[model samples]
Target: MTHPAAPARRRFLISALSACAVGGLTTSLTACATSTFPFIPDYYTFSQKQVQEAVQRKFPYQRTVSQVFEVALMHPVVGLLPDTNRVSVRLDARLASPFLQQPVNGVFTLSSQLEYDPQSRSVVLRAPNVENVSVDGDAQAYTQQINAAAAVLATQLLTNYPVYTFKPDQLQFAGVTYEPGTITVLTNGIRVQIVEK
Candidate 1:
C-alpha cells in the first residue's frame, strides 16, 4: 500500500516549489504569468471650458426655476471659478406679489464646491453658498428678510447635483473603476484621480 504520508509530502513539495518560483521571479516566468485582475490608477481631467459649455447648453440663455410669493427666478449665467474653488451661478430674478404691483429686479449669486463621492461613483456639487445678493429700492428690505431662506433654497437645489456621473460600462475601459480621492481645482479645470479595485 502507498504510504499515507507520501501524498501530504508531495503536496507540501508542490506548494514550496510554487512559492519559490513566485518569490524568485525570473523575467521570462513573470512575463508569461497572466493576471486578468483589473484595476489601475489613472487621472481624468475635465476642463472649465467644458463645464462652461455644458452649463450653457443645459441652461442656454435663460431658464426659470422655482417661484415664491409670485416672484420667479430667471436669466441664469453659470461660471466655474478656480480661484474660489467653487462653481458660481448668477441669476437675474424678479419678485412679484399682490402687495407690489411692479416686479422687483435683483441679482442672486451662489457658489458650490466640487467633490467626488466614491460610494456614488460621481463628482457632485456640495454645500452651496449664497455669496452675494443685490436688490434695488424697497426690494432690498424684502430680500434681506428672505436672504437666509433663499440661500437655503439654493443650497438644496445644488446639493448632490452631479458634475460628472460615470456609467459602469465606461468604468470598464482599460480595467479602470471609480477612484476615491479629492477633486483638484485648477484654473482651467478640475482633475479627478481614479484607481483600480
Candidate 2:
C-alpha cells in the first residue's frame, strides 16, 4: 500500500528541480548581455611603425634644389618628447645628379612644438630648428649651399607631418559621433580624444 504522504513528497521534489534549471539558464543569459554592452575607451596610442607609415604615405616628397643644384627629400624618423610638448625629427637627403663626380649624403635633425588647428582640422607642427647637420666628405664647398637646401626640406616636414586630423562629417560611426578636440603628445605617440558630450 502507498504511504499517505508519498504523492506530496514526489510533487515537491519535481518543483525543486524545475526551479533550479530555470535559475541557471537565467544567470547565463544575464552574463552574456552584460559582456556585450557598455564599453568606452579612454585613449588611443599609435605605434612608431604606424606613425612612420602614415607620415611616409601621406607626406609628399619635395625637391629642395632644382636647376642649379640636385637634391631629393625623403621620410624622417619622428619621436615624441617624454616630458615636453615637442617632436624630434631626423631627415635623410641624397644628392643625386648624374653630373656630380661623387655621391653625397645629408642628415638633419629638427625639433618643433606641436599645435592643433581647429579651422582645417589638422595638427600643424611649428617651424622646426635645425639641431644638427652632417654631410658626406668634403662638403665644405657646399656647406652653405646645403644648409639652405636642408632648411627648405625641414620646413616642409614641419608643415606636413600631421599627428591627427578628422573632418566634421567623417566622424560619425555606429550611432556615436567623434568630433575632433584636444590632443596630448606622448613619448612615443599622440592621443586624440573625442569631444565631451
Candidate 3:
C-alpha cells in the first residue's frame, strides 16, 4: 500500500510541473509578441498626427483655412473625440478671373474618417463630405444658404479628395483650364480659371 501511494504522489508532482512549464512558455510567448512593437503608444493617435502633419506640409500657408474648413464639415461629436482617427479641413479662398471683372471669395469645408488595421497595416477611409460655396452675397438669407451648402460640399470634397489622390492632372470639366496634360480644380468655379500645373 505504501509503495502504490508513493507512485501516485510522484505522478501528481510530475503533472503539476508540466502544467507550470506550459503556463510559463505561454506567458513568455505573449510577452515576446507584445514587445515586438512597443514604439507605437497609440496607433490611432499616431496616424491622425501623421495625416495632420502631411496636410500641414502640403499647404503650410493655409493652416488657418484648413482648420476652419475641417471643423465645419466634421460631425461635432466625431471631430471632438481624441484619437478618433479622422481629419477635417476648411478653406476660405478668393479668386479673380481674368475673364470676369469681379473677384469672389468662397468658403469650402471637408471632413474624413480614417481607420487603420494593425494586423494588416492597412488604412481605410470612410465617407467624406465636401461643401463648396460662395460666402459673400447681397441677401442675408442667400448668404446663409450658400454657406450651409458650401459646408456640405466641403465635407464631401474632403472625404473624396484624400482618397482620389488628386494629383494636379485628373480634374477636368467645362470652364476648367488644363495646361497640356495636367488639370486642377478651383473651388470657386465661377470666379477663376481652374488651371492645371
Candidate 4:
C-alpha cells in the first residue's frame, strides 16, 4: 500500500510547482519591461542653442571707457570648445565717442572656462579672454582702444557670470543630495554629471 503521507507530499509538490510557475512569469514580465524602458542616468545636457539663449540674456551690455567712449555689446553667439572644455562667445559691439565722427560697429570674440560655484549653485564662466576684435568702416583709428575696452568687458562683465543655475529640486533626487561634478563640453552641447554629496 502507498504511504499515508504520499498524497500530502504530492499535493505540496504540486503547490510548490504552481508557485514557481507564477514567480517565473512575473520575473519574465519584469525583464521584458526593463528591456523596453531603459534606465536614465544622473546627468543634464544643454544644447548649443540653449546655451546661446542663456548667454544672450546678459546682453546688451554697455560700459563707459575712460569716461569718454561708450561700448555696447550685444547679439551674443555661443560656441562650445570640446577639446578645451570651454565656451566661446562672439558679440556685436558698437563704439561711440565724441572723438569719433560717427559710431563704429565691430565684433569681439571671447572664450572662458566654466566652473561650478557652490555658494550660488550655478555654473559660471571664469577668466574670460578676448580672442579678437574687429571693426567695420574707417574705425582703424581706435583699434588699440577698442581692444583694450574689449578686454575690460571680458573681465569685468563676463567673468563670474552664471551660464546655468541649478534649481533646488534638480540637485535632490531620491532623497539623496547631488551636486554637479564633471562638466564636459561636447561638439553640440554641454554635459554635467551629478554626484552624491
Candidate 5:
C-alpha cells in the first residue's frame, strides 16, 4: 500500500519540475533573441598582404615621356609608414629611349598619405610624392631627366589611385549605415574606423 503522504509528495515534485522547466525556457528564449557577440568588430581590418595585393593590381604601368622615353613600372614593394601615416611603394622601373643604346633600369620610390574619396568611395593615394630614384649602371647623364620623369609618374599614375574599396555590405551593419572614417597606417597593415551616418 502507498504511504499516506506519497501522493502529496508526488504532486509537489511535479509542480516544482514544471516551474523549473518554464523558467529555463524563458531564459533560453531571452538569450537567443536579445544577445549579441561581444567581440564583433565595429571596424574593418586589412592585413599587410591584402594591402600589397591591392596595390599590385595597378602594375606594371607604362607611359611614354616626351614621346621619347618609355617608363615601365613593375614589381611594386609596398611598405606601411606608421610614423607619417602614409604608405610607400618601391617599384622597379625600366626606361627606354632612342637616345639610349639600351634600356636603363632603376628603382623608383614613392610615398603618399591615404584619404577617403567620397566620389570614388575608396581609399586612394593622395598627393603622391616621389621619394627617390636610383638608376642602375652609367645613367648619370640622364639623372635629372629621370628624376623629373619619376615625379610625373608619381603624380599622374598614382594620384587618387585606390588601394581599397568598401563593399556595399561592408558599409552596412545591423540595419545601420556606416562609412569609413579615420584611416590609420600600422606596422602590419591599415585600420579603417567606421562611423554611422
Candidate 6:
C-alpha cells in the first residue's frame, strides 16, 4: 500500500510543476508584448524627426509676421516602473526685432502637458500654456526678419515634438538645417554644433 501511494504522489508533483512552468512562460510573453519599443532611457532623443513632422502638420504656412512660437520639453522623465511619465514643455518665442534684421531671442512661458500609456506604449503631448510677443521693427525688414525667424522657430519646434514617426529632413524649414551625422546635440546646455558629414 505504501509503495502504491508513493508513485501517485510523484505523479501529482510532476503535473503541478509542469502547470507552473507554463503559467510563468505565458506571463513573460505577455509582458514582452505590452512593453514599449527602444527601451533605452534616452530614446526620446531619437524622436526629433517625429516632433518636427507633428509641428509641420500643425502649422503648414508662414505668411504673417505677428510673433514666433516654439515648444521645448523641460525636465522630461521616462521609464517609470509601469508605463507612466511626466514632462513639461515650454513654448519659447520672440517677435522680429524692430531694430535688428532678425527676431529678438527671448524665452516665453508657455507650458504643455505630457501623458504616457503603458498598455498602448504611447505618449500624448498637449500644449496648454502660451505667451506671445509683439514685433516692433522696420516694416520691410521686420517682414523679412519675421519670415526668417518663423522658419527657424518652426524647425526648432518640430525638433522637440514628442512623436516618433516624422523626420526633420522632410520639413526643409529655412535657417534651421539638419546636417545629419555631423550635428552633435550636447547635454551641458551647450549650443548645437554643425559640422560636415
Measured against the true structure, the TM-scores of the candidates, in listed sequence, are 0.64, 0.60, 0.34, 0.75, 0.76, 0.26
Prediction 3 global C-alpha lDDT: 0.37
Candidate 5 residues 143-176, lDDT tens each? 8888988898899988998888878766765777
Candidate 4 residue spans exceeding 4 A from truth:
1-40
How well is each residue in 25-87 modelled by candidate 6, as lDDT tens digits? 534222222122211111123333344344335442323333432222222212111121222
Residue pairs with backbone overlap in model 5: none
Clashing pairs in 2: none
Residue-wise lDDT of candidate 2 within 1-197, one digit each (tens)? 76979888788666655565567753322222223332233334455565566556644365637454566557678777757667777777677544456767777777777666766666667777777778887664777767776677677656646755656544554677555455567776776555533
What lDDT score goes with residue 68 in model 1? 41
Model 3 per-residue lDDT tens digits across residues 73-120: 221211212343344555555433332245455555555555433233
Clashing pairs in 6: 49-166, 51-161, 52-158, 98-136, 98-137
Using alpha carbons, what is the TM-score of model 5?
Answer: 0.76
Residue 48 in candidate 3 has what lDDT? 36
Which candidate, 3 or 6, would have the higher TM-score against the true structure? 3
List where candidate 6 sits over 4 angstroms from the true fold: 1-86, 90-94, 97-102, 115-121, 131-197
Give the local distance difference test score of model 1. Answer: 0.64
Error of 1 at 32 (Å): 25
Across 1-197, the per-residue lDDT of candidate 1 in tens digits comes to 76999899788767755764676543222233334322232466777666555444434222222434443566667677778778887866666654455777777788889887766778887888898888766666666554764576576566777777666763555544445465777777777665555
Of the candidates numbered 4 and 6, which has the greater lDDT value?
4
- Against the correct fold, how does model 6 do in TM-score? 0.26
Scanning candidate 5 in windows of ten residues, the lowest lDDT window is 30-39
lDDT of 2 at 29: 23
Cα RMSD for candidates in order: 11.1, 12.7, 18.8, 10.7, 11.7, 16.8
lDDT of each: 0.64, 0.62, 0.37, 0.82, 0.81, 0.35
Task: Kindly give the stretch of ten consecutive residues in candidate 3 with the minimal lDDT sum.
Answer: 184-193
